[model samples]
Target: MSGHKRFWKAVSVAQENGLFEPRLDGRPIRLPQGKVLAVRSSALAEAIAGEWGQIAEGASFTPDSLPLTRMAGTMIERIAPDPQTTRDMLLGFGVDDGLCYCADGINPVAEQVFAWLSGYGIHPSVTDGLMPVVQPEGYLEAVGQLLATQGDLDLAVLGVLAQATGSLLLSLAVVGGAVSLVDAVLWANNDEKSQLATWGQDDELVRTMENREKDILDAGMFLTLGRQVSI
Candidate 1:
């Protein structure tokens, strides 16, 4: 019942400037707008090729099934539209990082969050108010430095992960090998998870956490898969 048809007999990857390009039938693939489809990651390129390779002679594929390739396109078409826009977006994630907040308790989850913050060179000081105040002076510069070499797609997914985790630092931790994707998500939701544990779970909170978990996993796994890339 698939309406897709394969008109090409072969799919291959070509290298360019430390990036990878997908080729079909000895010709490089193009975007829907006829622009060249390229990626800065070998693993990602191979993954895209695998998507195309999986299509049977008569089978069709959908965008939903090709998230990796779609993200590559989105990177070129949307995320890195301009240098200023990307910089601003990167700064947005650093403004209100999740690690800057505390749960007002001595629980293990909160303690763990404090530990990661300390590891990242952030030291919290007791304030005059009822809450602890922390400023991530180094977070902005670190994330911006990360953006220096990251292609559009990398920034796009990092933004997604940052928003999902409510902490650019955590997302960077995921990208920088400081923590696993699942651990990052679990930590991001630590406060809520702890609260929900004793108070009971509500549909809204549960659903929100579920979606965040999925986004974190998708973005984090994509980054992990790209780790093998030579660049």
Candidate 2:
């Protein structure tokens, strides 16, 4: 809900059916689809509640202020409903992953990321040009199997990371803790950075880059909080 006034007097967390629910004024918060928002992780619920709590009374707010809540809703309403579809969507990001089409020599980050995927038996073809390289069926199947193992929340975070960086390799690396968020952003934007260096800064490009950074950081935090054991 964008441009809505903060109507709740207080924000809190409630335990329900062994799940954690963020409450507003003693009532559980509902997703956009009208379902109560319940999460398996207490830490995630608390953090989501904190987002609501931070809004000043009578102040205007937007959904952008509730990144974790949106992600949680996506987990419940989207990923949980049809996991196979979600897995396919995520796996498609790997098909034309930016890391695999570097124009320059092999990227160190790509090398590390490919090695990591290799452990899962997913070996994508890398090329030094813009032409599309068809990844083998075995490679795609392996990646799909790997994605199938991730929980809904993990897939939600991976979706955000993949969209933000346009690189499934970087997304996996970030989720695996093999790459820092800062470095991931840098690696994702290397081409843009090089262009900016030559052609000078564009305000729109800078803003786009900033937004990407925010998205990556938010997803990273969401995954970290969601993984915490409920207590």
Which lDDT values do the candidates have, in the order given? 0.68, 0.87
Compose the digit string of candidate 2's lDDT tens values, residues 14-112: 898899999998998878888899999999999999999998999999989889988999999988999789889998898888888877877788778
TM-score of every model versus the real structure: 0.67, 0.95
- For residue 111, model 1's alpha carbon misses the true position, in angstroms, by 6.2
TM-score of 2: 0.95
Writing each residue's lDDT as its tens digit, candidate 1 over 1-231 gives 125467788989999766688888878877765667787778878888887887777566676556666666767666756755775776676666555564464445435545665665554332334453555467556556655766655676777787787776666656656667767777767767877998896888888888788778777656666666663
Worst 10 residues of 1 by lDDT: 123-132
Whole-model lDDT, candidate 2? Answer: 0.87
Instruction: Say which candidate scores most in lDDT.
Output: 2
